[model samples]
Target: MNHFASIARVPGDPILSLMEAYRADSHPGKLDLGVGVYKDAQGLTAIPKAVKLAEQRLLDSETTKSYIGGHGDPLFGQLLTELVLGADSQALAEQRVGATQTPGGTGALRLAADFIRHHLPTRGIWLSDPTWPIHESIFAEAGLQVGHYPYVGADNRLNVEAMLAALNQIPQGDVVLLHACCHNPTGFDLSHVDWLQVLEVVKARELLPLIDFAYQGFGEGLEQDAWAPRLFAEALPELLITSSCSKNFGLYRERTGALLVCARDTEKLLDIRSQLAFLARNLWSTPPAHGAAVVATILADPELKMLWSDELSNMRLRVASLRDGLVTALEPHGLAQRFAHISQQRGMFSYTGLSPLQVKRLREEFSIYMVGSGRANVAGIDAERFAQLAQAIAHVCVE
Candidate 1:
C-alpha cells in the first residue's frame, strides 16, 4: 500500500503563486507587486549599506558558533526591546517587559500563538478581518480558536466603528491582535483617536492586546509609529507584542524578530517569560544569530545607528512618494480622485479597490501582478515605469 496516497495536494499560497506566475511571464514590461519586500527604484532588493557594514564588523569580531541559549542573544533582546518600547519606557523601568528573540516576525507570531494555546487555552484570538493571510493560518495551525473583527468593510475603508462593535461582542480575556502600524493587506491604519476608542473597548471587554509591530518605521517615523503600542503598554497591566526587524533593518532573510511581554510587575513578567522561553525551545531551539548580532552591533554604535536610521528614513519616504506618484499619474485618466486613498494610506501596501475581475485583467491583459484582493506593495513600484503601471491600472479600472 502507498502510505502517501491518502494525503491530498494543497493549493499553493495565493501571493506566492502570484510570484511564480510573475517570474514565468516573459513580458518585457512585467511588473511584480505581489511580494512584500522593499525594492529599490531599480527593482532590486539590495542589502542596506549599514547592514553590510555591521556584518563586516561581526565577521571581524570573531564570535563563537555555539548556541546563544534558548532565549537567543541577550544584547539583541535588550536593544530590540528598547527599540520597540522606548528606552525610558515605564514598563521597562518597572521591570514589567521581557523580550525573546525569534526566527522572524512570523516566528514571533507563531511563538505567541503557541504560548496562548498552551497557557491561555480557553481564550480565542481575534484578528482583523483582512489581516495578513499568514495570521489566520498560523493561529489555526497552533490549534487555537481564531475569530475576526471588522477592519475593512464592503465600501473598502477602515471601519473602526464596526471593528469596535465586533470587539465589544467578543468574550472578555480573549486575545486581540492589532497592527501597530502599516497594517498588512489593507494599508488603512487606525488613527490616534481610533486607537483610543479601541483602547477603551479593550479595557471594558478586558481583552488582551497583542500588538503586531512588523513594519515599525515604514508607516511613519519610527517614534511616531510606536505610539499605539507604547500607549497600550503604559496603560494596560498585561500586553503581548511581536516586532519584526525585516522591514526597518532590511533583515528579511536573516529572520530577526522578537516577542515581548508586559506584565503587572517583575514577578508576573518572569512567570510569563519562563513560559515563552519554554515554548520557544520547542519551536526553534535557538534562533539564527547573525541577524540579531548585526542589529545589536549597529544599534550599539552611534555612527552605524545613524546610518541605518537614515537608510530607513529613505526607504519610508520612497514608498510614500510612490503612493503619491501612482495617484498623480492616474490624474490624466481622471482616476486620481477615485484612488486618492492610495496617498492617504501609509506603509508598503495599499488596497487599490480594484475588483477581482480588474485584478485579473491587470495580470492577463497587462503584465502587472498584485494580489487578487487588490493589495499592492507600494514599495515595489519602479518610478521609471510609473506611467506604464498607471496606464495598465487605468485600463483595468475602465474595463
Candidate 2:
C-alpha cells in the first residue's frame, strides 16, 4: 500500500545547504563561496558579448528544430574537436579522433564512463585523491571499480612525487582520470615538468589516460591550459578527452560538451565512436542543440571567435587577479605565508589551508561561506572586500 515508504530520505548536498544558509542569513556582509559558477567583479554572472551576438545570429539564420543526429550537431562537434585539439593536430589530420556532443561536461563524463563500462569493463578508474567529488560516484554508479592516487593532502599541498609514485604502481591498463588543467577544489596543477614525469609513469605502468578538460581557458591562456591534454594525446596511442563549453563559452545552462576519443587509427576510432553513439542513444536520445549551435557559430566565425577568445581571456585574467589580490590583502594580516599556495594555484578555486574549525567560524560568525574542505570559489570574491575577507580570515585563524 505504501511502496514509496520504503525509501529513506537523504541529506541535501553540502554546497546546496551552504547556498540556502547564505540566502537566509540576515547579514549584509554575507559572502557565498560555495557555488561553482563564475561571477564578475560586480558579482554578476555575465553573458559574454560574443554569446549575445551568436544568439542573435542563430535567431536570424536558424531554420530547423529537427533532430541533429545521435551525435548532435556535426559542425559543433567538428569545431569543438579543433578547439580541443588544434586544427593541424595529428589526430585530426590522421582522422583518428572522434567527438560526440553531450548534455554537458557531466554528461560527457557519464557517456564516457558508460562506454568504458560496456567496452572496457575490466579497467578500474583511477581518480586523483581529491578529485571533483562527483567523479567517484559517476564511475562507481556505472559499476566500475574506482581508485585514487595521491594528490592534495590535508596540509593543502600538492603531492606530485607521491602521485607519480602511486601511478607507477597501479595495475596496467587501468584508466587514470586527470584534470587537463585548472584542477578543481585544490587548484594545484601539475607543471610542465611534472606532467612529463606523470607521462613517464603512465607509460611505464601502461595506464589509459582520460583527460577531463572542463575549464579549458580558465587557467592561463586557452592554449597554455591545453598543454597537458595535447601532450598526452600526442604521446599516447589512444586517449579519452571530455571537453566542456560551460566555463569558457559561458554556456553553463545550455550544457554544451563533447566526448573525444583518439585511437591508433581511423578504423579503431570508428568502432569506438559507434559504441559511444549507442550508449548516448539510451542516455539522452540526443544532446541539446541550441548550446552546441551557439558554440559552433562562435568558434567557426573568425571575428566572433576572436571576440570570444578575448572575453574568455578577460575572465581567466580576472580570476588570476583575484588570487593575487587575495594574497596581497592577506599580507597585512601576516597570514600570507600560510595561504601562499593560493596565489601559486591557477583556476577559479583555491584550498585556503583553513581547517574545518576556522571555516565554521567564518560561516557562523563572519557570514562568509565556503566548502567544509576550505575550498573557496576565488571568482566569487569581491575585489573591494579583499581586506575585509583577509581580516575575517585572520580573526578566524587566530581566535
Worst 10 residues of 1 by lDDT: 62-71
Question: Per-residue error at 267 for model 1, in Å?
Answer: 1.3
Predicted candidate 2 versus true structure: per-residue lDDT over 1-399, tens digit per residue: 988988998999888888999999999998988788899988988999999999999999999898988999999999998888888788789899889999999999999899889999899999998988889889999999999999998778899989988998899999999998889878999999999999998898888899999998999888888898888888989999999999999899999999999999999998888888899999998999999999999998999999999999999999989999999999998988888899899889888888889899999999999999899999999999999999999999895
What value does the lDDT take at residue 326 in candidate 1?
95
What TM-score against the true fold does each predicted structure earn?
Answer: 0.99, 0.99
Model 1 segments beyond 4 Å from truth?
A: none
TM-score of 2: 0.99
**RMSD to native for every prediction?**
0.9, 0.9
lDDT of each structure?
A: 0.93, 0.92
